[model samples]
Target: MSKVDADTQSKWDEQLDYKKLPDWKDCASILNKRCQYLEARDSKQIRSEQCVKTFNKNSSTKPTIVNPHRPQTSLAANQRSCILCRDLNHSITNCKKFLELSVMDRFWKTKKLGLCLNCLVKGHSVSRCPSSYKCKTCEQAHHSLLHRTQPADTNSGIDTPSDTSGQSTSAATHSAMEKEQVPEAQVILATALLLIKDSSEGFQLGRVLLDSGSQVNFINEKFANSLGLRKHRKNVDIVGIGVTETKIKYQTQSTIRSRYSNFEISLEFLVAPSITGYQPEASLNVSSWNLPSNLELADENFNQPSQIDLLLGAEAFFDLLESGQIKLGEGLPSLQQTALGWIVSGRYKSKYNTTKKASCVANTLEVGLDKYFEKFFEFEEIQGLRSIWSEEQNECEKHFIDTIKMLPSGRLMVQLPFKKHPSCLGGSYDIAFRRFLSLERRLSKNASIKSQYSDFLKEYERLGHMSLVPNPNLDEDHYYLLHQYVLRPDSVSTKLRVVFDASCCTSSQISLNGILMVGPTIQDELLIILLRFRLYRYALTADIVKMYRQFLVNPSDRKLQFILWRENEPTPIQTYQLNTLSSVFG
Candidate 1:
């Protein structure tokens, strides 16, 4: 026994008071709190030590593994497993079974289980007969004597019982119950996802959202374009609690869409803002926003594509939470049918799943090295290719056509940056790709690679390498150079002729040549027109967005210009793209 528990028991014996004596539960509660603090502290220390070891090991081992070291720009911090379903040797896929375990198993393992008479194991009264005897081999007379001492009448039942005849079992059986919510202020109340069936039609993924605080809500852009709602635009600022700075760039646009040629409707949720925001203004009709949920995924198997319209999301639901139509605590008291026409209770505890999904998801999303888990969340395609990445096809062709990253072996890996469904990572390959690329197998599998590389030409970008590090060496005021001066808003000849001088002597740096009326570039042409009405001296405003991010030097080229942030730190290869801009006065 723990020293504290032993002391507590001694005090209880001497005081002859059960209330004064800390029971196993009370002692355990105290220990649990202490253990939590200790575990957190130890985890931090272990992580630190591992970091140091990682450096030392890198010194002796392969340092910037060429392909592996390539910087990857991910929006999230290391992935997090579902707190409730992470370590129960099961995933959310199997979470339903978690509820069948003892209450303690459920609490520590998943939200599925609750503290109850079932887990307490002492739910019935001793006089209930069968429990009075300790063994099946015991004499029936002995068992009967033990149970008979107590009168069968209610008055006696209510009164003090005879000695060693009756005992209180579960406080839960006859008492009220209360369960508190998780301690996070930002919690998801409900979520919905959708699929656009064709250019003109939309279908509901058999779901709608009723809560707020969801990370992201999406709609198919293709669906939006077909609906012809493109002309209507909604630019909403995502402000408020827990919003990231990058979200300022998101602007909402609308489009019209429909489902089945016969079932034409409009869909507009698919436009992703450049930046995602918290209090972000989502595009919605608000009061009139509704979807036809009559069409569910024809295939219960999530592997195949679903014929759906728009996935109801943060736009429609977050607005509802502020109005209090949605409650955060208990699964709703009543089950409501979706517009798609099915009985679905907000009681989202997956009862229909034969296998637990929680464990499957948690184990799959686990960050560290474990091939089985990493691929658990990934899906296989028609020919049984586990990932879209096929070595038989070559680098550019690996991802069918939509260019995603590649493992060393050249395979596609899908991570759902904004998935909030009950079964977040379910089914097979066809669905995993839907988060980023369209799943239509139209036009030979090679259609995606050409556009992927061509998009870079649209901008005068340089850092091409910063997609991997936490910080970068690029400076500000350089991004303005990315746009190739095309044409001015007003028709006029620009006097400024530009010169570009860049070198790899240190890090890639550029110096622009300045002169007016010498060249007819877009910037110069615009300057010439503006000068017509204004004085010779003009206000030259210059700004750089993500300067450091734009100049990412790939790890392989790090020795040339990438400098270390610390003496022993892993040669901090920059991750996200940072940019820089500069301009000269005439």
Candidate 2:
């Protein structure tokens, strides 16, 4: 009651009769209902007043009655205003002030106003702008006002004949003269020479860029390969300026250490084909400029253009900064102390008067609407219309037909259809050993699963489907398949199934399945098979046990299907070759 407003309380008190006062509980409920109604009424009145004020500000004339049926349209119209002039009378597209500005000036104004270049609107960035409007001049996603006209003779000068009339030549020369020229300034980016750990357990000097703006670190693919670092597969989309998109397939981890100091840190970086174009753009003459002699510079040749091998993101940037800093004269780069060394960055005036073009580089990631629609339509394609055989598939089938042989025991043996020679597969023993250790730990937790899995492998060996390698140290091209078991409690036949992973990648980042050609589908679809089963007068169904084991793999191909196994803890782990057809292959 004390919290209620005075006007509402007074109205409620007047409504009560002294001779016939209601019960205490009923009176409380009535008061609560009255307070709610009053609060809602006040909110509605405040909103209406705000709306009327907005309408009055946008409209120069007296307020007119807004039709209830079309209130939304009137409100939307009143809310519309010119982004450039902030005038409610017209939108930015129709604003005369915006159209009068020069092309370069319009671009700067749009950036300064924080308006979307695509739609010329505020509140959202160009990358996230929903409007699909494109420039009429170039059909780009930016507004027409931002499009720049190119000079005619820039690329077509050689195409013109020498016999052309002087008037035509003079017009071409005039167009080239009208082209804009801007002075070039040398800008130094923060870079350092750091030691990065390689696959051989040695450190190598690599050029690194320090960027506090990036959220994730990146490494150059060529540099990463030079270091011989093992990369793990990771699919990530990288977006850049103007919402341009790219993808990274691999990432690697390594330790970085300062060359002059003992400061060391480990980092994970996504591997990109290239971080960016060479830094500094061109060489700079530093004879006239003065720099501190006592400072240990991060990069000795910061003024020279060089490839960036790595980019340290914000996660490592802040930690490397120190309190020490030195500021030079105006139009000169300043020095900031860091873990690596003193980093020189900022603007630097050059003595050369040559004209050069400037460009902006930004890395961002975004999935556009077109990509989603493309993926959605991909699933809608008719699979039956697609060609069944390709060049590689035909070659694979021919190889199988030529190499296949029948054994004396009435079993067919076929060679694995490889896309390339098997020598490309590097060492896979370590990878397989780690996976086997992991499987052991998982099976240790469940005794019943462990027992069933061991029995299945023992049964497979008893059937002569696999055999132990005579010498595991044989110097030959080999691949190891990672094995695991799958459990099915409801199954009436086999309760456990041993599954081999042929897609496990080695140090070379190449898997056995990656090099092998997947044969075309020869089996009918399940729907067709079921429909045919119903048409028969009588149906008989049977499942073939160990169907894959019925066919044998060639002696040469068996080496590629090696596996690590042990029957129990007392037994030593031994390498075995699968002599029969593996389920991983069709």
Index of the highest-TM-score prediction: 2
Total backbone collisions for each predicted model: 71, 2
For model 2, the superposed segments whose C-alpha errors exceed 4 Å read: 1-100, 103-232, 235-361, 366-395, 406-411, 417-442, 462-464, 467-482, 486-496, 501-547, 555-566, 571-577, 584-586
lDDT of 2 by residue, 1-586 (tens): 3446787667667767666534456556767888688766766665565456546565677655432111123444456687677788656654556555445666788899998787666765665554445665567777765665543223322111111132232344333323332223567789898899876457899998898888889998878977767799999887776788778899999999998888999999999877876776766656545788888999989877899899998999999998998888877788999989999888766543222444334543345898666656554332331244556657877898899899898889988999978889988999899889999999999999999999998988999999888687546889999999877889999889998998888889899998997675567756657666656679898898889889999887899999999978778899999999977721
TM-score of each candidate?
A: 0.22, 0.38
RMSD of 1: 29.6
Q: Name the weakest run of 10 consecutive residues (lDDT summed) in model 2.
A: 157-166
